[model samples]
Target chain A: MREAYHEQLNQLADHLAGMCGMVADAMELATKALLDADLAIAEQVISDDAKVDEARSVCEEQAYALLALQAPVATDLRTVLAAIHAAESLERMGDLALHVAKAARRRHPQPVLPEPVKPYFAEMGRVALKLAHQAEQVIHTKDIDQARALEDADDEMDDLHRHLFTVIMDKDWPHGVASAVDVTLLGRFYERFADHAVSVAKRVVFVVTGRMPGSGDEEL
Target chain B: MREAYHEQLNQLADHLAGMCGMVADAMELATKALLDADLAIAEQVISDDAKVDEARSVCEEQAYALLALQAPVATDLRTVLAAIHAAESLERMGDLALHVAKAARRRHPQPVLPEPVKPYFAEMGRVALKLAHQAEQVIHTKDIDQARALEDADDEMDDLHRHLFTVIMDKDWPHGVASAVDVTLLGRFYERFADHAVSVAKRVVFVVTGRMPGSGDEEL
Candidate 1:
């Protein structure tokens, strides 16, 4: 029974990792939709959200069953709990991607963001993609160092986010309220995407170290 | 051993309920500060956030210890797990309240929200307060119907949020970027506060029903 539970738990972890990949792809596609103003990709991201939700439900059910049946203790308990946490984080990531896609779809014909902010948006996209990939690596290898690196990478995205805000705040730009709203919303999406990735990294740290990282003394 | 574990689980639930009360009060204080533009109250909210965090940590540690030492299964396991979820939701509520307080402090003497929107803000605040109180009741009574009502109340906040945006968009609010940012952030705080309340309610439902509420529902 223990071996079977272990196998079930491993399968759940793999499913979570796979969901993260899909969420990462959704973010990538949503970012591209924003940059290229591709309505098709935007709609695709929005429509595909149900799949992510389904994956989350399955992962959650599996974790609950393992806890109920196996009565897992200590490390095994932490692993199951972390799987649930990771699944929720990934689900939220998918929702953030959907939010970005919805915003992109709203301003279909006209570009959602100004050309000046393109570089920042691109960098944000790259950073988010990297974080997502790193999260999957953490799940697969349970590598605390890789997870730590993902945490560090979020700082760069934060810097870029601040820069984007500065650009928006500049009086030189003749943009209207729509532009400001788009920029602010876009910044929020990027920041939250990074935050969810950090959450995943933190869970990985917890899984390996049996303690939550960045809880004290460590800069988050 | 089972009886002791059950007793510890009950104690954990009580602690979680206490934390929820703290969070609800913090949220109420923060909203009042926003509505009244009271800097002192906002500061108090900020200062009290550490206490909420501490409460959450204690609850988590207790739940973890119970699970590790007692290895609770079946209903006992579910009860402990629900406590963990409730702690996280309460912590998030505290954070949301802090966000509101921080935003309020930043805009001391908050410019009178356009007269037309004052009632909307008030209504949002009232609903939030009620939801917070309802969350406490749900915890105390383990009443699924009361919890469901809290979930339904979330839609009211959502409606108010939409109305707020509509008003902002309809009027040519001269303040432009600052006003828009302030209003948007405020709306986000209210929405998030309600979301946390609903999450707490969901946990309550989970505790009683032994299954999550709105799990497969995609209406949200």
Candidate 2:
């Protein structure tokens, strides 16, 4: 019975990692749509979001079932609880990617990225996708160092986000107000996408160390 | 022992409702700051967000303790799980309010809302505050009808969000590119704030009916 419960917990982790992969794929495609004005890819990302949402619902239901039947305690309990939170974080990441895809679709045929802002958004996309991939690995490995490193990566995304604004706020911004609005929102979607990855990584660290990330020496 | 566990579960609900109240207050103040250019109120909202975060942490911890110690099953287990999700929703609402405050601060001494957009945002604020208050009631009453009504209110917010873009995209948009960016983000913040409220309400409906809200007769 104990072995079975442990196996269930492992399955929950695997499901979460699966979610991370889906989000990474969605962001990768959504970013491509944003850069190339590929309407088909953007639409695909939007439709694909439902799959992530369904996976999250399944994951959470499994969690409730495990708790009800197994009543896991101590470390096992924390692991399941963290999985629930991590599922939520990943679901939100998928939603953020969906938002990115929607933005791309809204500007369909007309590239959402003004030429000046194109390179910055391309970098944001790469960073966001990389973070998602790294986050999936952290979910499986529970590497505390790697989880902490995701935070540093998030800081880089933030820098990129700030620089994006500078380009818009530049006195010589060639694009009109509408383009600036789209660019600002696009920057936000990518920044928030990275933020969710860091959040999931933090939960993974908590699962491993039983110490909430950023809680320092304070034990949970 | 059963009675004690039940009492703990009630406390968890109370904590969640308390979070809803804090988020409502934060949005109210943040909106006021945005319209009036009140830096102090914006700063107050920003600083107060930590309290909401702490409250959510406490609420989740209590739920975890109840699950671990009581080993609740069936409806009781579902209630605890819903509380965890609801607490997260409220915490995110608080974050959205914090964002509204931060945006106001960014434009400090200068109102974030241009004159043409002021009334629109003002209405958004009222709608958001109304939804938050209604959401608090839904948390306590679990009134399925009221919970469902929150979705209609969310539709109202969505309409307002769309209208905001229309105003921004108007040929006579009085504000320049930067102001348009600010207004667009402000609209998004309010829309998302209301969205969190609707999500919490849906969870409440699920708790009461044992059928997922929007799932209709389909059982999850």
Candidate 3:
């Protein structure tokens, strides 16, 4: 029974890592859909988001089962509870990706990113994908260093997000209000996607170090 | 031990209700700051966000202690786990309020909303505050009727949000791209604030019914 309990715990972590992988792929595809204006891939990402939702449900159910039947204590208890929070974060990351895809679908045939702003988004997507992959690794390894590294990578995303804002708000910006609005929202989606990835990494830190990374959602 | 455990559960519920009250107040003040360009009040909301964060930490700590010491099952278990999720939703709602406040501060001396868009924000603010209060009440009563009511109310907010976009994107829009960006992000903040309030209400329904309101974060 103890062995099975531990196995269940391991499976919980594995499930979280797998969800990260799903969102990472989702973010990548969504980014592609946004840049290339591929309606089909965007639609595919929108539909595939259901899988991430299912995985979140699975994570929560497994955590509940572990708590109810196994009553895991100490580190194990934290692991179960952290799994719940981590799944929420990853699921949010998936939604952020979906929003990116939706942006693409909304503007089908015409790319969401104008030429001037395309590079910023490309870099943001790269950083967001890297953060998601790091979140997956952090979940599996619980390596404090790897988890902390996500925060640093997220800084690059933040810079890109801020820079994109300047481009949209620039005096010479050719893309009028509509395009500016689109870029503003898309920038936010990518930034928030990175934030959720950092949030997932924070959960790993909480589980391993038994300390919070910051106050709450604002910081994360 | 059983009696004490149930008290802790009630405390957990009470804490959630209190946090909603905090955010409801925060949302109200933030909206006022946005509309009036009240720098002092905006600054107050920004500083006071820490209280919401503190409340969240306290709730999570109380929950962790409950799970570790009590090993509650059945509804009790659901109550504790749902508390964790609910607290997170409430905290994010607080952050949304903070973001609105920050938007106000960024454009201090100049109102964030252009004249035409003011009515829409005024309506959005009213609906968001109402939802927050409803969320507080639902946390207290676990009233499914009230919980479901929040969803219906949120549709109004969504319409207001959509309408704001139309106004901002209109060719006659005189606020230029900068104001449009501000309004876009502000609209998102308000919309997301209402969504979090709905999410908190859904947690109550989940505690009572063990069902999901939707797929995950996107729907929430």
Highest TM-score against the true fold, candidate = 3
- Candidate 1 interface RMSD, angstroms, 1 decimal: 3.1
Task: List where candidate 1 sits over 4 angstroms from the true fold.
Answer: A215-220, B109-119, B215-220
Question: Arrange candidates by DockQ, highest first: which order?
Answer: 3, 2, 1
Error of 2 at A111 (Å): 1.1
Global lDDT scores for all candidate models: 0.81, 0.86, 0.89
Ranking by TM-score: 3, 2, 1
i-RMS for every candidate (Å) is 3.1, 5.8, 2.4
lDDT of 1 by residue, B50-87 (tens): 99989988998898788778877766777777778778
Give a tens-digit lDDT track for model 3, residues B1-220. 9999989888988999999999989999999999999999999999999999999999999999999999999888998988999999999999999999998998899888888998998899999999999998998888899899998888888888988888988988877889899999999988998888888888889989988776343332
User: Backbone clash tally for model 2?
Assistant: 0
DockQ of each: 0.41, 0.48, 0.66
Q: After superposition, which runs of candidate 3 have C-alpha atoms over 4 Å from their true positions?
A: A216-220, B216-220
Of the candidates numbered 2 and 3, which has the greater lDDT value? Answer: 3
The candidate maximizing DockQ is: 3
Give the TM-score of chain A in candidate 3: 0.96
